[model samples]
Target: MAQMRFITALLWLLAAAPLAAQEDARPDLSIREPERGARARTYVLASLIYKDAEDGIDRFPLAVPELIQYVEDNTELDVRLRGEDRTLRQLDGITLLYMSGNNAQLRIGAEDRRRLGRFLQDGGLLYAEDVRPRGLGRFRFGDAGRSGTPFDRQFKELVKDPDILGAGGSRWRKVPRDHALYSSFFALPDGPPPGAHQPGTITDLEMLEYRGRVAVLFSDLNLTYFWGDPQAHSRAPSLRFGVNLLVFAIARQQAGPALR
Candidate 1:
């Protein structure tokens, strides 16, 4: 039965691929800043560097611009398109960190992991996605023992105990349907947008909350690819979801308390 369901979902995605392709054009890279003298917020695309994963940073080229445009067009926040790729150690004033890669064996040092932990504990949000090709060492929830790629293993290590948010036994779990993140800026009634990565199964948008705010938002489905074409019909919900994430993170940061 599970196999049948997977087959059906694959077929559906295949059927929709052509339509998505038709709309897959380069997005408008020009960023429109608010007339106000200085930008209010800046989103960072933290480029993950791993000794084993050299090409990891090359996956999502359009993600930064699309996210920048989406936030500016839909909200009153004065956001800037500052997509400077930086290491985890340089996360001083950054509020949001978007990390995606294809390597499963990716590794980060203990010091960098501690730095990331501190950043999240300081009211920062980390949005991570694994973009490994479907059949090739991709990350599957139940198959973690077998299919867990390097990124998967490293990510799990990074969020383990004594890491600030992950301390006190905190862990990632399914984001409830009614969570504010689903409806912060745009209503995501059906949860995360469907992508070629995971078809039949609902791609779980896992969250790790500390105190009363979410510190990490993770998806195994390479959502960065979903931000490919801003004008694509199927890309709207995904883009909106991205905006909602940014809005939620910013609101929580301004609410004062870092950890309850």
Candidate 2:
């Protein structure tokens, strides 16, 4: 009886050991990417100077806060908002670099331009918007009160492939009804603001190849204007476009890896 009792206790101990080991093991959540098999790591870089009210520019409010909400509602991708205190070296970990025109000071410099070139070459996707003072397309940098259209001159140099952007310099074109972004991520009232709308046409779209990686760089079509405004619930069209742009960014990144 004693020997049989001891054997029973030993079996219990052995069974519990595996469970204990599993509990002790640290889960590598870092390697996990977004849902739907998205492997791209997304990062938002914001400049400190852009937020300073003393800079004369009306520090626009569209930024990481809005991005966080979008990510929470949309995808499971790991997203982080980085500031100037961080090193440019850490940029390697990021697959998508969101350049909200909020950081005009950083985007306009010569040395910074060189760094941006290398970043794009190393498979980093850029989603740039001209979020000038006042409203989304109302303020251009240096040129006071100028309409904040797409930063054409700079992108023209980066996106050398003419096919990326149509004959005109607009990076954002009307996303057609049959486009992957329209069906997969957006549709009708819920998707990209329908094909028959005013600004939903794909007038200026670009699929530029940089460092063997094709990137779809685009403007948010007045997205920043609608952000952070509680009274603007009627702007469903703008919000849908914002969501579509994100889906497009992630989808474009995945396209390269799939072909490989």
Q: Considering every candidate listed, which one attains the maximal TM-score?
A: 1
Per-residue C-alpha lDDT of model 1 across residues 1-260, encoded as one tens digit per residue: 42233233333322222121123352333534324446555545454444554442425656767777766665555445466566777887665688776554546777877887788777677887766432354443222222256665566666774754556324768888877677655668888776545455546677776655677877775666657444445676677777777656555544433423
Candidate 2 lDDT score at position 253: 40
**Model 2 alpha-carbon miss at residue 58, Å:** 7.9
Model 2 per-residue lDDT at 219: 49
Model 2 agreement with the true structure over 89-154: per-residue lDDT tens digits: 344544455544433333334444455555555445665544433434433223321234334344
Candidate 2 TM-score over all chains jointly: 0.49
C-alpha TM-scores of all predictions: 0.69, 0.49
lDDT (CA) per prediction? 0.59, 0.41
Give me the displacement of residue 101 in model 1, in angstroms: 2.5
- After superposing candidate 2, which stretches have Cα over 4 Å from the reference? 1-59, 71-90, 102-110, 132-150, 154-178, 188-207, 211-213, 251-260
Off by over 4 Å in 1: 1-58, 73-78, 133-150, 164-170, 228-233
